[model samples]
Target: MKKISLYHTEIENKDGISGHVRSLTDDAFNQLTSSPLKSVPGTNPEQLLGAALATCLNATLEAEEKRRNLPHQAIVRVAVDMGRDYQGFQFWLRVQVKLPQVDQQEAQEILAICEQRCPVAKLLAKSQNVKIELVNEFGFKEEFK
Candidate 1:
């Protein structure tokens, strides 16, 4: 099979978790980054990771919904927790998906399919720290391990 590049971009961060992050491919894509432990006005890696997964997974679900002739009403919520483990600091991501227009069984089916199709979800699929769930309603709160 031939490899084709559909989209590509680069991001740079010089200050680790306390300064700025900018995209090399897009001039308008610049933002401040800070540690979640601090009360600073910036975004952290955890939030960014959550945003990526939620956005990508929901976009995949949108495509599937379109294909099924349904309205785009899928919601994705990702909660990222950072903690210390045996190997030092580790991250856990809890991804919850809600398809309000469908039944529980069908929503679960769509979530399973989307998990295999979403690029970000697929990238994190093998990690034992990541979990994807189909939810009837979002609580938006979770106890981290």
Candidate 2:
């Protein structure tokens, strides 16, 4: 097997409420809560997760189509619902994929392969816990232990 690539991002907060996320490419995004009443301006973690899953799934689907030489393109939308369960936090995702040039059966087959091929989807299927690092501006870092 070929070597895999590692993607990294750093989320830094001076206070506990708001912060910024910086990717390895130096792309910076402001991070904050999505509550309308408390309305802080920025993208929340849930939104980022949804975007990642949706993009990865769509890319996988396109790759599958290319392997099969099936001239098709898809519009993929993922809705991620985050709530609290008995174990604390739980996430539910609804993936809606629309393949315009293909029939329902072909679409189903593509979706099945995409689900298996998408790394994020496969990881989420097993309910794995991700390790997160909380770093303060004072250079103190804490990892989830």
Candidate 3:
């Protein structure tokens, strides 16, 4: 099954739809405005993408705790690092997991699995591209596709 669906919508009104997006799922909670700098405060498009990957890392680690069943002495923390450039953006999510009772091999395997399987991490590591489409709503003649 597909885990994510790419959503795109256009609005010309004041502030547009940037402020209207909310958590459609409990798993993915953080969202930010991607409009021009004049309209949004303290943010740009890259920051939002960083938040998405970080959120995924946290959620995946928490879920791994249950899946691994490491007794009562388990703790997990993930450090997400994001680097951006005009050329491209990349993420290096370092998952520092501590499990008291679990063996070293088991812990390593769990961390590796979580890091590789996390959806946002996968997207970022795979170098997903943003596809933009420009449409002219004011059609003088035929429709613009």
lDDT of 2 by residue, 1-145 (tens): 9977797566565544355554444556545544322567866667788788778877887898888897647667765566668988766665567776776777777777777788987877665442211111112122221
Per-residue lDDT of model 3, residues 1-145, tens digit only: 8766586434222344365344544435444455443655544444555466546665776677777664444443333344567888554443344555566777667657776887765665544432111112211222221
How far does residue 1 in candidate 2 sit from its true spot (Å)? 7.6
Order of the predicted models by TM-score, top scorer first: 1, 2, 3
Query: Order of candidates by lDDT, top first?
Result: 1, 2, 3
Q: Estimate the Cα RMSD of every predicted model relative to the unseen true structure.
A: 1.4, 11.9, 15.3
Model 1: lDDT to the true structure: 0.92
Each model's number of backbone clashes?
0, 0, 0
Per-residue lDDT of candidate 1, residues 1-145 (tens digit): 9989999899999999999999999898899999999998999999999999999999999999998999999999998999999988999998888899999988888888999999999999999999888888787565763
Quick one: RMSD of model 2? 11.9
Q: Spell out the clash pairs found in candidate 2.
A: none
After superposing candidate 2 on the true structure, give the runs of residues whose Cα lies further than 4 Å from its correct spot.
Answer: 1-3, 6-17, 28-37, 128-145
TM-score of each: 0.94, 0.67, 0.43
Model-by-model lDDT, in order? 0.92, 0.64, 0.50
Q: How much does candidate 3 score in TM-score?
A: 0.43
Q: Which residue pairs collide in model 3, if any?
A: none
